[model samples]
Target: MYGIVLSRRDFREADQVITILTAEEGKREYIARGVKKIVSKNTSHLEPATLISFGIAEGKKEFSYLTNVQPVESFFHLRQSLPTLHIIGYSLDALFTMLKEGEADSDIYQLYISYLRFLNTQEQVRLLLLDAFLIKLFSHLGYHPSLDACVVCEKTYKEIGLEFLSATEQKPGFYFAGGGIICASCKAEKQRIGEVAYPCGIKEINTLRFLLASSWQDVVSFPLDEEEYRLVHKLIYEFMLYHSERKWDDWGKISLIMT
Candidate 1:
């Protein structure tokens, strides 16, 4: 079937090694052999974030080849602004790195398309959109954070200080570690590093909770104040890093692009 071009790497002087998020195959990479030919119309149409219909031939194992492609939604607005183009580019790259090839993830494809469409809008709320996109994307990948109740004690985060274990801290700042909170009581039970709780305000936690719990369509239109928006931006970055277990270089850059 056809899909959107998520990412592309130059394979040669005149060809591109690319990955497409297909409805049938999820994410697949192939050599767009000779796509860069001077007279080839296909090469011009395969930009990142451009929706295109592509025919694929299943191969031996864990790979596929592209037979043909037709443009669908080009997301032309993404090209109008450099900062926007960069943020969306990084988001697409993150997806490319995080998703496995030949896996069927229709949900991810839909979320990605939604994110692209949202980004194409002329709203000055780029950071808000980025934060919302991360929360939705991470939730889909099963790395969603515990933003409501205390992850360790299973108690509602009523108090101002909500501690969580820090994965990489020598004297871990809070009880947050590896996707959950380690309560003060639970902290003593474990021999690992621990630290007292930090103040994670109710509003901050609630915003995260709402983002995780709500649908993208519903959440996209939701608004955020500057402080709340900044909290989400930081939380999602930490959440992605903590959950995915990988360092994303472009994430910080995307945050800066919005600023």
Candidate 2:
């Protein structure tokens, strides 16, 4: 089956356990026996994000072993660039943290493949692609943030009079616990209930809405200034962490790379 190596962990002696995201099987853990040996050809092919085809050997235990790996796309160029490498590492780390073992989702598998392909060719837009991928990944995982209207009141931005908010005006509040942007009215109501919200400027709010609504083709061309990019990155990263309930050590590193 065709798969991407998501992560690898050393096992007893020269063996290791490799977690692979397969096109057909979603995520599967396989034992690669003696792969830690000096002459093992499988070691390099098993690196994270390496795409390959391999056969599964059913073992007496619950897990399976990998055999006959044929490399498809190694994405070697990613290693040559520090920023791209960091993004790849962050992406893989997020995937590894969120994806459950043996859970099959073909859409996510395809999305991952597309992400790698894009990263392989487009170095300039890696950050944008990563952000877009994160948004889409959350959508695929059924945790898509409600960006169109107020999460609490369900009112449109125009109805809430946020569309005309000036740069100097107090920005709309983003209530992470409430799942999305809160209108002025709902923000007041939330305040009465002792729930605090994060302030998000009009530009940042609109940028996020566009991202959630746009395709990768369109998103690639979307213009974002350094400040706008920073806002979007912080919002998305925090949102993912809050919803996923997982703290990633690489978050600061990836943020630094984006800057």
List lDDT for all candidates, in order. 0.66, 0.79
TM-score of 2: 0.89
Best by TM-score: 2
Across 1-259, the per-residue lDDT of candidate 1 in tens digits comes to: 6688887887768778788887677877877767877887788678888998777676666545566778888988777887777678767877887888889888888888877787777554355556667767777777766654456666555432433333212221124463644334444544344443433344556677777667555565677766676655665676676667577763544544543
> Could you report the Cα RMSD, in angstroms, for every candidate shown?
5.2, 2.4
Number of the predicted model whose lDDT against the real structure is largest: 2
Worst lDDT run of 10 residues, candidate 1, spans 165-174
Residue pairs in collision within model 1: 2-54, 164-174, 164-175, 164-176, 165-175, 165-176, 165-177
